[model samples]
Structure formats: C-alpha cells, structure tokens
Target: MSRSTPRPEPFVSATSAAALNDLRTRLRATRWPDSPADAGWSLGVDVGYLHELVDYWADEFDWAAQESALSRHPRFRVEIGDLNIHFVHARAVSPVGPALPLVLSHGWPDSFWRYSKVVSLLTDPGAHGADPADAFDVIVPDMPGYGYSDRPTGPPLNSIDVAGLWAELMRILGYSRYGAAGGDIGSAVSRYLALDNPESVVAVHRMDAGLPVFTGDRADLSPQEQEFLDSSAAWGSTEGAYAAMHRTKPQTAAVGLTDSPAGLAAWIVEKLRGWTDCDGVIERSFSKDEILTNITLYWLTGTIGSSMRMYNANGSIPSEQHARRVEVPSGFSFFSGDLFARPPRAWLDRVANVVRIKELPRGGHFAPFVEPELYAQELRDFFRPYRKALG
Candidate 1:
C-alpha cells in the first residue's frame, strides 16, 4: 500500500481447496428449470441450453487449461491504497527500444482473459506489422474485487479509485509513462485513469467513447444525437436491469452467485449469449469450457461479492467529471457490435482524440475474444501513429 495514498485492501486470499470443492458440489446440486417448447433466446439463457452447458461444465470442462495459462504469467499482488491487486506483467518483445508499458483492463463478467489475445499482439506488434518501438509491456490487472482481487475492505470502490489504483500499479511496475486501453467497465476506469493522472497517461483508448461522460443536457443534443439518446434511454430502461441490481442490492444477489456454479453460469452465459457475435447458443460463440472456466474463476476466488461492490460504489458520474472534456490524447475503436457502441461523431468527439475509428463488418462487445484478429489489427492500427511519434 502507498503510505501517501493508502486505501483499504480488497482482494486478498490464498486460493482454498475447499472453495473449489464447494463450487463442484454446487454444480452437482443445481436444480434446473424446464424451457418453453417453442422458445428461443428471446426468453434469455434457454433452459435446455443451460442443461447442456451444465453437463459439460460438470464433466468435460478443462478448468486447468485457463488456470494454468493464467498461472504461467508470474502472478503477484500489491497492497495499493485499500486494494490488493492481482496482475500479470508480461514483458514486451523489444530487445532494443523502450518497451511501451500498457495496462489493458477488463470490464464486468470478463477476467483478464478478455485481453489475452491482445497481450501478445500489442507486446509483439512487429509480428503483426507495427514496429517493435510501438510495442507495449502489457500489465493486465484483475481490478480490485473483480477476478482474483476478491477480498475487498472498506465502503466501496469507484471508477476514479480504480483509476488511482491503476496509476499506483503502473508506478509499482516501474511504468512512469504508459498507454492504457479498456472496454465496458474497463473503459470507465481507463477514462478515470486519464482524468486522474493526465500527466502519466500518455494515451487513452476505449471501445465505448459514446457513453458521454460529461456531455450536457438534452438542449445540448442535436437531432441525430437526440434519436441516439432516445434509443440509449430505451436501452437504459429495458436492458440495464443488471446494472440496477448491482447498483442497489449487489450483496443480496451475491448470495446465489457465491453459492451455485450453475447459477453463476446462468448469469455470465446470458452475457455471452446476449452480447457476443453468436446468434444462437453460447457454443456457437464460446466453447462450453471457455464459458465455464471464466465463471469458475469468480466462484473459486469468491470475487462475486467484491465485484458487485462496484455497483454500490460510484453513484452517478461526478458533475465535474461528467461532460468534462478530457485533455489527454485519446483514440476510439467503434466496435459497433458492443452494447455501448454509439456512432455519433459528436458523441465520440466529446471525450476522445479519435484519430482512428473502424466499423467492423462483424463482432460484438466481447470483441477481443469474439474477433481477435480484427481487434488486434484495430489496436495495431490505432496506435500506429503514436508508434511513429514515439520513434
């Protein structure tokens, strides 16, 4: 913990054999529901679909594959402010030049696994086309109370607090100057990183620049923005039930997620089903093992409770921070497939430098895993100019 800026420790623990056992038992005891005969995903997380998923998770799922992959990265923890962060510091493939340090953060329901594809691609961009000088020493941290950082303490942590932790983590990793990128909740935290440590964050990138952090009222909205705003409002009302629960009664719902493996699958599978490029069952997009492994991390680490703390924290965007213009150099990837892909140029312009924007023919919110090649290329291309600037 930084003596100057000590917060409280959130994620800390020795992984228990008992926790893993409890998860398996929960999976074994899952009481399944029956599906409507003609029903499709319209009902969300189809019942029959879930049964097939649960069986595979119970029998064939390889949790070790993901666990070992994550373990090989020299995982370590640091007491920063109040959070004990779990992170992987993978060195860049630049034998000659400055290894551009980069912290790739993930959003809700996604562990560091979301950025797994981009890590090697960014750190070894010479293989992809960009110069080695542009390569970044990637530090992908499981945000406090999220993945492995489960044992949170104190009131609740907010985006700015997370941003501060990122700053401290970057410094702890000896990254005085580094680039940052994220999507979903990751995007919000990255924005705060830029906002909090404008001097330290050399460049900031986000998948959802259209969330309109500080943009003003409806009077400030144009006709086009007005329509998008209306659609956003509708989506907020209908699709944001998950956010509502997290914001208000996270502890209440953490009960089921912390208990049942199948229950956690139902929660996360809904996102993979609802948010990914796949139109039908999750298998169409992700293997049952992949889906199960991600959820299992939450179960094994008991992160469900701490991760939900994000909801209770950070009430609404701060008045000054909201609609507040970001001065740092910024870039945006218009992964229009994601939940927050707002395309209005004005909406995006408010918070980003936006040197490059691409409209992918395919992909969705989980673009890193959903469309690795395209997403990797987007990262390489957007940071190309900065690579040149660096040299």
Candidate 2:
C-alpha cells in the first residue's frame, strides 16, 4: 500500500428498490416485436422465448437473492487513475505453499459476474477437492465503464490502457509478481500486461488470439493463418453485427438497450445462447435466473453503452501494437465449443511464446461460468509450475 494509492473501500451489490420497481414496470410494459412464422432463433433472439423470459423477469425473478449471492465474496471499489475500479479480492483460504496471485479480466456482455462461480473454486481449491498448494489469491475486476465501476467520461480505455491500470492495481495491493488470465477483451488485456510489464507478470493465459490483423505483407502469411483470417471474416459477416454496432454506432443501439429492459435482455441474451456450448437450448447452459441476473446488472448500472464504446476505443490501437509478440511464457486454451474457428497453433506461435495449449473437451466462450470446476482445474494446472517462479 503506497501513500499515493487510495484505499479500497468495501463494496456490495445492491440496487435501489425504486430501480428494481422501474425495471419490473418496464419489463411488464414492454411492447412486443413480431417475428416471421416459426422464426425460432434464426432471426436474432427468439420472440416467443423472449416473451416467456420477460414474463418471468417481471413476475418471478429475484434480484435480491442474486445481489446477495454476488456480495458473498469480498468486494471493494478503489480509485485507479481516472476510474473508480470495482473488483473481488478473494485470498487463498488455506495454502500449502506460497499462493499465486491471479488477476482475471472479463469480456463484453458480461462483467465480473463472468467469474463469480469460479472465485471460490480458485481461492479455496482445497474445499473443492483440489490441492490447497494450487490455491490462488484471485482478483477479478469489473472493467471501467462496466458493472459498479465508474464509467469513462472521456475516450474509452483500450486493452493496453487497462493493462497498465491492472499493473498499478496489483502494485497497490502489495503484489510484486502475479499471473494474468482472461477471455474475450480480457485476453487482450492480459497479453498486454505481459507485454508491457514483463518482469512483474509471471505468466499469461488467454483463450483466444483475438481477430487476426495482418500488419505485414499478405505474401508472408502461412496457409493456416490465412485460413483463420478468412474464417474470422466469414464469422464477422454473419455473427458480428452487434460488435460492428458497438464499434461504429453504439450510441444508437445503446439508446434502446439502456431504456427497454426487454431490448437489453434480447440484445444480451441472444449472445448468451449463441456463444455458449448449449446446443441450441440456452437453458441447458444457463437458467433463466442466471441469464436475467447478468442482464439486470447491465440495466441497473446503465453500462451497456459505455461497455460498447470500448470496442470503438480498441479499434484505434495501432497496428504495430496488435502485431507485437509477447515473449513472456504464454498459455492458450481453445475450448471445443468456442468461436467455431479456433486459432491455429501457427497463429498462436506467431503471436506469443506459446508453452501450453489445451483443446478443452467441452465449454465455450464463457468457460468460467459454464464450467467452473473444469475452468478452475485448468488454471491450477497451468499456473502450478509458475508458482516456483513466484519465490
């Protein structure tokens, strides 16, 4: 704890009764949108399903219970640079060795809520039947402009910027060395943490290499790399309209998402179903309560807009920055059901000094939430060897 760094105040997740009432009122008053006959989910979020989900949300969902569940872990908010960052700092319960400090970053359409299920699994692995020696003092932060954290008033902060903030955050917490892991936007931030602060970051783990950006001559690309770019392009044309909107005209879409609870649910829930390994049945992966809890966080915090703007900010990261390779020991996990086109080993090798690669049998883009036990074990296995370096 430095004199310059402000102290972190204990925080809890509690929405005002008035806000909850307004949400229910809006959910009940939602004007339904018509869909083509037997549309199902072919044309965006299924209307019939949305109707049922909204009905449940308005009449049966329990925000208080969800809030209580979220607050069960130790949470705090502290001013980090210009933003008031909120994070969960769960220390190792009973360590058999020096517990490794791990910072987990999350991506869009989700907040720290993404890792809630796995926090205890990581912090107290002994109770979960894992070796206490593998325990991690886990830190999961809500990215700026998301969740309970303060929204950015100026330009959006990109991954590089956020990585710097995380470094400072770890320093403030008295950690001289730590491990970094993330999925989606978090993967980029974790990569930059290793890139920007190589000495302090013990190891880096990322789920994907992000969309391919060929900074050099097309002639130089390997065949597999070229295929990845083509596949990513195809995925974008079909499945990335929401991201395009987030990058270009987020404010326009945010207007509706911010105001209408149904619209917000529809926009986010669609991704939840499409991205997870649910095999077309969303409930197979997430119950209605789980789905609504995430959506309700976005609605209550009014952060959907700011969260979207992050895409816009990231668009401006220099091409050179995107092309930079990380020399720090890096690990990659490509879950079987994630973003259809898994990055080729050649691509991963080109981007970072890859040491470990795991083709997980199950799970999808939201691996932590979808398979907490599996995800926890993956982290424990990957970071176990690195713990010796912590000494």
Top candidate on TM-score is 2
| Winning candidate number (lDDT) | 2
Local distance difference test scores for all models = 0.73, 0.92
Residues 1-391 of candidate 1: C-alpha lDDT, one tens digit per residue:
3456443233323555676566667678898877788786676667777878888777777676667665655466667765567777778776346666778878888778787666777777788776666677778898888777646678778888888888988877666777888888888888889878887887888777644433467787677777777777788787788878888889888998887777887888888777776755567767777777778888777788778778778665567775666677788776645776465877667555556666776678888877777777776666655543344
Candidate 2 collision pairs: none
Candidate 1 ranges with C-alpha deviation above 4 Å: 1-18, 127-130, 213-215, 388-391
Q: Where does the lowest 10-residue lDDT sum fall in candidate 2? A: 212-221
What's each prediction's clash count?
Answer: 12, 0
**Model 1 weakest 10-residue run by lDDT:** 5-14
